[model samples]
Target: MDRIGLTTVVFRNRFASTKPKNQVLEDELTLLSTPEYFVDRFKVHNVEMWTPHFESTSKNYLKELKRSLKKERCKLINLQSEGKFDPSDPLEENRLKAVIEVKNWVDVAKSLQCEAVRVKSMKKSYSKAVLSLNEITKYAKAKGITILIENHSDLFSDYKNHTNIIKDVPLNNIGLLADFGNYSSNPVMFDSLKHIAPFTRLVSAKTKDFSNQMEHIPYDFQKCIGIFEASGYQGIYSCEQWGKANPNYDYEKITDWMIDNIKESI
Candidate 1:
C-alpha cells in the first residue's frame, strides 16, 4: 500500500492557476501546494508529478518545491517529463535539441530528489530514439536518476516498437513506464502491459471511466494488476484518471475508486 501514489494529472481540473486559460478548471493548486494535498487528501506520501504542474524549472522554484515536500513529509517518486520536441527526429539538430530539453528535466528531477523521470519517443525510428535516449540516460546516470520511456503516443503505442527502443538503449538506468490505457484496443493494451511488465520501473494506472458504483468499466483493471504482479513488478502504481475531456465528472470519487481498486488488485 505504501507503494501506491497518485499523478497530479488526476486533478487537472484543480490546477487552474498553472494551466493555460483554455485548459483551466474551476479550482486552483500551485505545484508548491500539491504535496500537502496529496498528504491530506490521500493519506499517502508518494507523488508522481506531471510536468505541466510545474510553474518553472528554475532553481529557486525547485528549491521551494523541495522544501514544501519536506514539510509535508511527501516523496516525489516520479516526474512525468513531457515536452513538444521529438527526441527521435531524424534531423540531428532537432534530435539534439530534444535531448537537451529532456536532460534539463532530468536535472529538475535530480533537484527534486525524484527516483525516476518519464519521457516519450515521438517518432517511428527506433534507432533515432535510441540515440536520443542514450544521451539522456548517460546524463541521468551521473545524477542517479532513472530515465523511463512510456508507451505514449506515436510509435511507442505499439509494444514491439516500444520494447525495442528500451532494448536498444543499452543502459541500466533506462526502463519502461508501463501505462495501462495507452493502447488502441483492449487486447493490445493488456498484451503490451504483459510484455513490458518485467522492464517496468513505474506504472501509470490510467483509468478512463467508472460506473456509478465506482467500478472500472473500460477493461479488467484487476486483471491488469495481476499481469504486472505475475511478471514480478513491485513498483509504484501511480493513479491517473483520464476520463472524457469534460470537467463535470467527480474527480475526487474517481480518484478514490482508482486508489481502492489498485490496492485491492495488488
Candidate 2:
C-alpha cells in the first residue's frame, strides 16, 4: 500500500490552465504546490509529473520546486516527458534534435533528483528509435538517471519490438515503464504485461471506467497487478486515472479507489 503513489495526469483538469492557450481555471494545481496537495489530500509521498504541467524549467523555478518537495517530504519518482520532438524520425538532423530534447529532460530529472524520466517511442521505425535512445541512454546513465520507454503509442504498442529496442540499447540505466491499460485487447494486454514485467522499472496503474459500485470494469485490475507481482516486479504503482475529462467526476475519490484497488490486489 505504501508503494502506491499519484501521477499528475489524474489531476489533468486542475492543471489544464497551466499550459499555453488553455483557459485559466479557478482551481489550478501548480508544479510547486502539487507535492503538498498530494501529501495533504492523498497522503502519498511519490509523484510522477507530466511534462505539460511544467510552467518553466529555469534553474530558480526548479530550485523552488525542490524546496516544495523537501518541505512536504515527497519524492519525484518519474517525469513523463512528452516533448514534441520525435526520436524515431527518419531524418538524421531531426533524430539528433530529438535526442537533444530528451537529454535536456534527463538533466531536468537529474536536477529534480528523480529516479527516472519516461520518453516516448514515436513513429514506426524501431531502428530509428534505437538510434536515438542509444544516445539518450548514454547521456542519462552519466547523470545517474534511468531512461524509461513507455508503451505509449506508435511502435511501442508491439511488446516484442519494444523489448527488442531495449535489448539493442544494452544499457543498464534504460528500462520500461509498463502501463496496465495501453494494449489493444484483453489477451494481448495481459500477455504484453507479462512479457515486459521483468524489464519494468515503474508501473502506470492506468484506470478509466468504474462501475457504480466503485469497481474497475475495463479490465482485471487484480490480474494485472498479479502478473507484475508474479514476475518479481518491485516498483511503485503510480496511479493514473486516464479517462475523459469530466467535470462531474470526483477525481479525489477516483484516485482513492485506484489506490485501494492496487493495495488490495498487492
Candidate 3:
C-alpha cells in the first residue's frame, strides 16, 4: 500500500481523454485481467484509480465521473479541472466564477468520496499566490477535502514560488501533489520534488521513456525514490505515464525497487 500505483492512462494509447468512456472501461479491464504481479511486487495498494477529466465540454461530467468510479471500481485520487483561479484578476466576474467552481468541486469530491482534488498553481505574483491559496484553503477546509497542486502549467516551474503559496495558506489540508519526470521543460524536477516533499499529501512518480529525447532522459526513478525518502515523504507515488510507447512498465517491480531505496536513504 505504500508503493506507487499507475494511472489507467499508462496501459492504453487511445484512451487518452474523456471521450469514449467505454474505451476507458475496457482499458481498465485489460490492465486487471493479468496476474497483477507488479501490484504485489511494488506493494501497490489498489488496482483502480482515476484522475477524472473535469475539464471536458460535457455536461453531467461530475455524475458521469461518479458512475465511472463505481463502474471502474477505482478510487479517484485527483480531480483535474480546467479553469484557472487568479486572485489578482480584478475582474469580479472571473474571480466569482473561480470561487464558485472551487466550491462545487468540493461538493463533488465529498459526494464521490474522493480524498484529494488537483488545483492549478496559477502564474501570479508572489503575494498573489498567497492570497489565492488563502481563498482555496478556506473552501478545502470547509469541505473536509485536501487541495493538492500539480506542477501543471507555470506553477510547477518553481518550488520557491509554490512555497510562498504554502506559507500563505499554512493549513494541513492544503498541500502539494509532488510530481516526478515532469517539468522537464522548466528543468527542475528533482528540486521541485524536494521543495514540495514536506507539504506533500500525495506523491506522483511520473515516468517517461526519454530514450529518444534530445535533451532530457528518462527519470532516474530509483534515485528519485531516495530523494522522497530523504524528505520524509510517505505518501502514495502514482505513476502517470505519457505517450504511446508501452514499456510494459511494471509498477510493482519498480515500486519494489523504489521502496527499498526509500528505506536505505532514511
Return the top candidate by lDDT. Answer: 2
Residue 87, candidate 3: C-alpha displacement in angstroms: 6.4
- The best candidate by TM-score is 2
- Between candidates 1 and 3, the one scoring higher on TM-score is 1
lDDT of 2 by residue, 1-266 (tens): 46887999888777864323554564688888899999998899998999888889999999999999999999999999877679999888888888888899999999999989998658756898998898899999999999998898568878997788778999999999898877788899999998999989999999887766777778988889999999998888999988654556777899988888888978
Output the worst ten-in-a-row residue range by lDDT, candidate 3. Answer: 29-38
C-alpha lDDT score of every prediction, in listed order: 0.84, 0.86, 0.57
lDDT of 3 by residue, 43-115 (tens): 4433324333333423475556566555545555655444565543456566656656666666767776777
Query: What is candidate 1's lDDT per residue for 46-82, written digit by digit as tens?
Result: 8888888888888899999999999998888888887
TM-scores for all candidates: the values are: 0.94, 0.95, 0.68
Residue 91 lDDT (model 2) = 86
TM-score of structure candidate 2:
0.95
For model 1, the local distance difference test gives: 0.84
Off by over 4 Å in 1: 17-25
Descending-lDDT candidate ranking: 2, 1, 3
Considering TM-score, where higher is better, how would the candidates rank from best to worst?
2, 1, 3
